[model samples]
Target: MFQNLAPAAVDPILSVAEAFRADPRPHKLDLGVGVYRDANGNTPVMTAVRYAEQQLAQTQTSKSYVGLGGNMRFSRVVTQLILGNAEPTGWFTMQTPGASGGLRLLADLIAASRPNATVWISDPSYVNHAPIMRAAGLRVASYPYLDVASGGLRREAFFEAVAGLGQDDVLLLHGCCHNPSGVDLEIDDWQQLASMVSQQGFLPFVDLAYQGFGDGLEQDAAGLRLLADASEEMLVVYSCSKHFGLYRERTGAALVKSAGSKQVQGKLFELARRSYTMPPDHGAEVVAMIIESAELTALWHSELYAMRQRVQSTRHQLADALSTNGMEAEYLCHHKGMFSMLPLSEASIARLRDDAAIYIVAGGRINLAGLAPNKIDTLAEAIVRLAA
Candidate 1:
């Protein structure tokens, strides 16, 4: 009976967890997933979230369903965070299960808007990106990013990709904390993108998942805000999972900024009517409770800052160790996210998996959060041996 179905390939990013589960190596480090793990190797609950949970737990009123687009209050809060407070900008807000859900929905929406719209993605982009857009019936093309030579944004190459694109094409840009590959465009680069995006008339789509994890909450949002300020119309996918530490509750919003308020409201309604209407209440409530409460907001910011500092420190430590081990690559300091691209070959990746039980993706996009203080030496040794 089961023979009718063919073997299914696992999701590349998530498949790492499955492999880790089967491995018996006690010292093995799991750097595959894009989750935020603390120094102790656990993704701890934010202090604000804990407080919100306690408060909500004590006085929760109803478990009723929220019609398309979860809660109104939550959407407003999301709009404020992603779009910032002031604007004559037109926008729509739809809450999805998570950012993944929002991304899929946005792809579908874009496809529906203009069929076969070519989405320009970074060559070595987040693994799931191409799949989502391709599944939506849109074409995916790569622009050269992460020039392995310098391990930074290939700015000239990126502009070339944009230059060849049609006005209807969609350019998917990471607002902050680029996933898998952590190379972020500099402010001047973003300004150029904004001007180009405006001039070329190609649609802009922003994947903003890690807001507070990179530089700071507002600092990370700089690019997104810049794009929003420039574009007459744009799409932004929001994820509160990392920012609020609500991974499982599935809280995220799909935002579209238009030229006018009426257009924004209409698009929001239509988008809501077409897809999963409302975002989840639990996560939204938690975020709202935290943000609205001054004390909780402060606590959340502190936690976020601490987490940011830890990642930056770990990144420095990694680059230092790599240099000490006699390697001269310098992308570590420039990368601004939880992940980093290491200089590794296919044979080396395979060998590391087999011999050292050191797991990383084929492209070597490692989650910096997975490197604990103690495991750093082990990882450094593994890298040095394999690199040698």
Candidate 2:
């Protein structure tokens, strides 16, 4: 049986990361991974998180497991953070290892309950979205999201695709800060989409991994809040990794909002119980402590704001560089958050990696946070020389 196992294909994102790590070039740049880095090109720990950790290390008394649902206080605080004023009487939630784990848990729930449902994701979305959904035995499909021709959102195509979604389908939307493509829906666009969700009986599944990295915490959540208000039922997966700089801590939550029934809550608990049993405690506990304290929460907001501004600044700078090179890249300036996709072919991406020693994902997705401010011009020159 062991001899019959076939080799699995390597994940493209991880493969790029591995290749970047093995390269010894002094000037090599990595723009593939989706982590927030400062102007100095480092993923720093937020002051609030650091303080929380110090507090936890010194005062904490136990290393015991945090139940299948993790910390209750964490669940309550994080759910409040995500849903804002939305009523929780109709919602079911669980603490997961990370947003990835939440996605898997939800996928398992979907597969177990509605095995025939087809989960639709954006054409160019987070690399792992489809895989995790498929791994949990759900069928995955794509809807148009990007316009490669103009290097912007394919809005009309998106509406057209969703219009075709049946009642049994599940639409996976990037709550904000769309991965791979930083293009996000406007308030009006979200309202229109919510109308579609109401008209067509499909489930609205939101993946909110970059809440504070976009326009603002409240601004980024506008779309999700709209959905919650408009739809009778919805699914959301929240991630604290990026905003909190808790990448290694693996903190996240999965939420469900539907009318009157504790059945969904029971299912979520059961699903989480079998997978990982429970999430890690340190990160969520830190998050809860910080959010619970007004002072710490204020500090966390300031740090989150600074991180957002840095990424936005890098975006503007890169856009300026591309414009100077005679490329139509003003769209990059408007796109928010850590990532934006360049309209580059596979050969151009290969050339960028091989000749320029600049690493980017095959689909031209680059993490704006990964670039140091000083290297903006250098990257621009490389793209101009190679891709232009």
Best by lDDT: 2
| Runs off by more than 4 Å, candidate 2 | 85-87
The per-prediction tally of clashing pairs is: 6, 0
lDDT of 2 by residue, 1-388 (tens): 6898889878878899999999999899999988877888888989999999999899999999888888888989888888884556677777899999999998998898789999999999999999999999899999999887777788888999999997789999998989989989899989998888888889999999999899888898888888887889889999999999999999999888877447887777778777688899999999999999999999999999988898899999999998898776988987888999998888888888999899999889999989999999999988988985
Model 1 segments beyond 4 Å from truth?
A: 1-6, 259-277
**lDDT of model 1 at position 255:** 81
Q: What is the C-alpha lDDT of each candidate?
A: 0.82, 0.89
Q: Estimate each model's TM-score.
A: 0.94, 0.97
lDDT of model number 1? 0.82
**Model 2, poorest ten-residue lDDT window?**
85-94
RMSD of each: 2.0, 1.2
Q: Once model 1 is optimally superposed onto the true structure by TM-score, how far is the C-alpha of residue 112 displaced, in angstroms?
A: 1.6
Over 1-388, each residue of candidate 1 has an lDDT whose tens digit, in order, gives 7888988767877787788889999877888887888889999888889999999999998988886767667778778777677743467777788888888888877876688688988878888889889988899988888877678878887888877766778889888888767888878888887888778898889999988878887888888788788888888888898878899999988887765656555555566566666667899888878878889989988988898899989998888888888776567887887888887887887778888888888788889977787787678878888856
lDDT of 1 at 36: 86
